[model samples]
Target: MNRNLTSQQKNAVLLSMAQLIAAEKAVIIKANKIDVESYRGEDIAMYDRLKVDEEKIEGMILSLQQLIADVDPVGKDLFHFTHENGLKITNKSAPFGTVLIIYESRPDVTVEAAGIAFKSGNKILLKGGKESLNSNLKIVNLWHKALIENNISTNWVEYLNYNRAKIQVFLENPTQKVDLIVPRGGEKLIAFVKQHATCPVIVSGRGNNFIYVDIEANLNLALKVILNAKTAKISACNAVDKVIINSNLIAKETFIKKLINKLLKFNVEILGDVELSAFENVSSFDSDEIWFKEFLDYKIVIGTVNSSEEAIAKINKYGGGHSAVIITKNDKTANTFMESVDSAAVYQNASTRFTDGGEFGLGGELAISTDKLHHRGPMGLQHLVTNKWYIYGDGQIR
Candidate 1:
């Protein structure tokens, strides 16, 4: 394994990667074009994430630049203590050794997530989906170029070009050391990794995120937030999937009608709970299982709740544990909902789409983790490091 590269060395490689990506923009785009054209899947979201343009290339370069500017995550002092026996001990941040990240069609992960992991001092093993193979290989080649230019070992960034069966075999019996595994995709992939991997897995789980429209909410504001959260980028994990409207909301019928009309403008298919089925355009769902689904498409579910507590209960019961929001003018109600909702990110009067690493001021993220242990929310360079205890003793015995 390539271990203990200095912060300067890592930053130099990242800077070189940014320069290379910028210089080879056309090449990268050409590669992504092949992946996009070859993708036979009907998943619009995956297709959207697979295709790369000049803007996405710029985003990749920007991610590298931002990661270069961020603080080094390794070697920071977390805690210190001294014993009376002249023994000193300190806990400091350290890399997780080799981190295996298994993800789906998003090609940007090849650059952004790898940059975060590399900057945090961990050797990364990226296993991107086959749908984006061409694009991923192009990016990985650039990573190799950057590493070689810096005289750093290319082992720092390795790509596992394996299929599902091969990946399962690798997970069950890794050829190299793997300290942590992060699965970033739909539930099936996360479940598959969890079921097979021997190492500890950090789940970058689904996002059946919800929004509650409180009785005191500004309907106009709620409408705008819902529209953006649900329609702005349906492919995003932070996109809102379910909406819980307080049954007693003023002009509830009028608001629902307006929301339905607005959503229909974007060609969104609206699903409704039992109470909401009365609305003309809203289709009623037969199974409660729909609440647990993360629809990465132009679809949304609208339900009704009696109170803030009820809304909180439903969100906790059915949400993806990713993000939930409450639209309200009441501080007490907002605080209650924010504190009560069990999710990585909770919002009040804002769009759930803001639940992102860069949007939350973390430059870029390795993954938007829903796991409570190790870390939650956006796993940035700072969040990627583990801790190690260092002890100093001059002929002192325990």
Candidate 2:
């Protein structure tokens, strides 16, 4: 539905949704409580993401309001030129037609993700998991209300409640035209979508993120960053799942011991590579497959690297290509690590947690794309568009 909406019309829908969310906060929370109550999973991360409290509702409203203040993502000129035959040609931003977002356990995605697609002038179809079915339904109803209030087509926002089998069928033969598909969930869910979907699928939501503590890293800073990255929000895709330490760092054992003590407070399970086998409360990775796993739980792996080269190679081999951080005081080391590490976002002396769209100053994100095509990192409003070429000719022939 790239029907050429004026900027005012788009912002109106977002503002209306914000107001609707504010007015329906209690009802929304009530519905979310049902979802939370029905959730019987053992995964703490999934449980955490399933809950929608008052603060989370406020955050949803804030995301919509923030999106309303952003400029229109479409129709901006990327390039313009006069052809040799005197034809005026212009290349400008355009919508991706319809965007289908498949997510699990997050009702706010029903708001923020849909808002980005609508504001970009693309229709959005939401496929939320059964865990958040009640919550997602309520929020999508609010979306329909906002569209009606703005005199827009309610079809612009649709909620698809399909089982895994149904979803697989739909992906293979979508009932409607699907320009882009974004699967925002764990590795299994992403793999499911990529395996079945015929359309272009942007890989999002997996994070086997890493933080390398260089030999020159300040122990205090490394501890602080690692703790925040690993425990601040265990469910986030940007959360740190691995910590690689420089083998020759001063007092390396002491640092690991201190790190273990801090992590114990959060009750995080620590796994170590063969080099780190001696630490207490730290177990060895049962298999090499653990290196490729994105542990969305209170679990982490700590490995030792002899040099930055080893760390880079290790990360490139097993990392999710989502986010990687290097903690060091050396500028040259930071630069080389940042450039050589193949992640969507590279950090120096900062937590991997800041890979988020809001933190990166893009306002809000639809998803954190690990794929290199079209976009990478947090997919905000500006990244939701494609480009089209327009030409005006006056009887010109080659």
Model 2 agreement with the true structure over 1-398: per-residue lDDT tens digits: 43888999999999999999999999999999999999988988888888999888888988888888888889999998997789999999999999999998989889889999999989999999999999999999999999889888899999999999999999999999999999999888999999999999998957999999999998999999999999999999899999999999999999999999999999999999897768889898779889899988899999999999999999999999999999999999999999999999999999999998888877789999999998999999999999999999989888
Q: Which stretches of candidate 1 lie over 4 Å from their true place?
A: none
- Candidate 2: list runs displaced more than 4 Å: none
Against the true structure, candidate 1 has what lDDT? 0.93
| Whole-model lDDT per candidate | 0.93, 0.93
Maximum-lDDT candidate: 1
Tens-digit lDDT string for candidate 1 (1-398): 45878889999999999999999999999998999989999998998888899888888888888888888989999999998898899999998999999999999999998999999988899999999999999999999999999998999899999999999999999999899999999999999999999999999999999999999999999999999999999999999999999999889999999999999999999999988888898899999999999999999999999999999999999998999999999999899888899999999899999999888878888899999999999988899999999999999865
Q: Check candidate 1 and list the clashing pairs.
A: none
Give the distance in Å from residue 299's predicted Cα in candidate 1 to where it truly belongs.
Answer: 0.7
Q: Cα-based RMSD of the predictions, in order?
A: 0.8, 1.1
**For each candidate, what TM-score against the reference?**
0.99, 0.98
- The 10 consecutive residues of candidate 2 with the worst lDDT sum are 1-10
